[model samples]
Target: MTGPEHLSGTDRVAEVIKDIDADIIINIQGDEPMIDPAIVNQLIDTFEDGYVEMATVASTVIDNFDYVNPNSVKVMIDGNGFASAFRRETKDFEIGGYYRHVGMYGYRKEILLQFTKLDQTKNEATFNLEQLRAWTMEFQ
Candidate 1:
């Protein structure tokens, strides 16, 4: 069983994994069972770099999305292939910079533990995106 105090799935994962021995914790949403195993394997491979403490999957969105809609969260990846932001709102609805943010996450064990204990950020509460807390806290 997990604690009721868990505000997010990641929090629950942290609770379940605290005493377990593992190098990586893949936090995939219960609803996302269809996530591609190949992509997950690739993401896990990125951890071999040692500097990557956390990572999330993202894919190019071919369909036009309503940027104002909270459901279509976009991942801002810089030219160098690093995520700079995750947001539901953007003024640049015309041009580009819209990569669909996949919910799957890979977190190092220690980082996951530290993440669960931190307080939520304003942007996180506003957008209901817990990853915002990680971004704002300088987790990079």
Candidate 2:
């Protein structure tokens, strides 16, 4: 299915989910060994209202260097606490309220299936963030 092997994480996810059956799926990164159970519970609770399609956790950034570091993924949250944007670069106005995006994600089963089929957007490719592909498609 590929000459150059450009399957991104989302693409691989699409491939893996073909056989799974579930109502809700939570994706927690393998590297996050100390992920809080409370955060996972909070993300799961968001689905109980039945309005959220996709959700992720973001932590308050305590260090200035992490806020400006390209390795840290910063998220802009809306007035309602939903994510507005995800980026490696921080905006000028975000210095005070910036939240660093945690790698975990919760997705409705159908939405997760649909996400795998989406084409990678330019912003996603540039940032190397598969989540942006979902954001670009307005999945939430």
Candidate 3:
């Protein structure tokens, strides 16, 4: 029942839940049907911190193929285990490693609504990652 006007999965989810009463919302991308439930639980638990407005999962990357694959998004984690950046591919001279970004997203209801209302950011368009849009807005 999703409309064609929605540009991203988050937008469609926002529309569907607009009338529902909920504090937290979880978004799982179509390509990630097989993702582990434990990860989803972990995402939900992140809301225990009032400071965490949004959260996503990331797993360690062990294989070289996934690291080089453009379809498998990579996440650079800061010292606090929060993602610093997301990218499809690594730079030639990049020194450190990155984790495989899980496709699921957890958002507070208010943040989800606000996020869908904003237009896409340039970094999001260039990287093809909705998370980038959220990240850019977090700082701005």
lDDT of each: 0.83, 0.79, 0.85
* Top TM-score model: 3
Candidate 3 lDDT tens digits, 47-114: 99888988988888546887788998988888887778899988766535688888899889888999
Error of 1 at 59 (Å): 0.4
Which segments of candidate 1 are over 4 A away from where they belong? 66-68, 93-95
Model 2 residue runs over 4 Å out of place are 1-6
Native-structure RMSD, model 1: 1.7
Which prediction has the highest lDDT against the true structure?
Answer: 3
Report how far off residue 64 is in candidate 1 (Å). 1.7
When summed lDDT is taken over every stretch of 10 residues in candidate 2, the lowest stretch is 1-10
RMSD of 2: 2.6
TM-score of every model?
A: 0.90, 0.88, 0.92
Please tell me which model should have the higher TM-score, number 1 or number 2. 1
Better of 2 and 3 by TM-score: 3
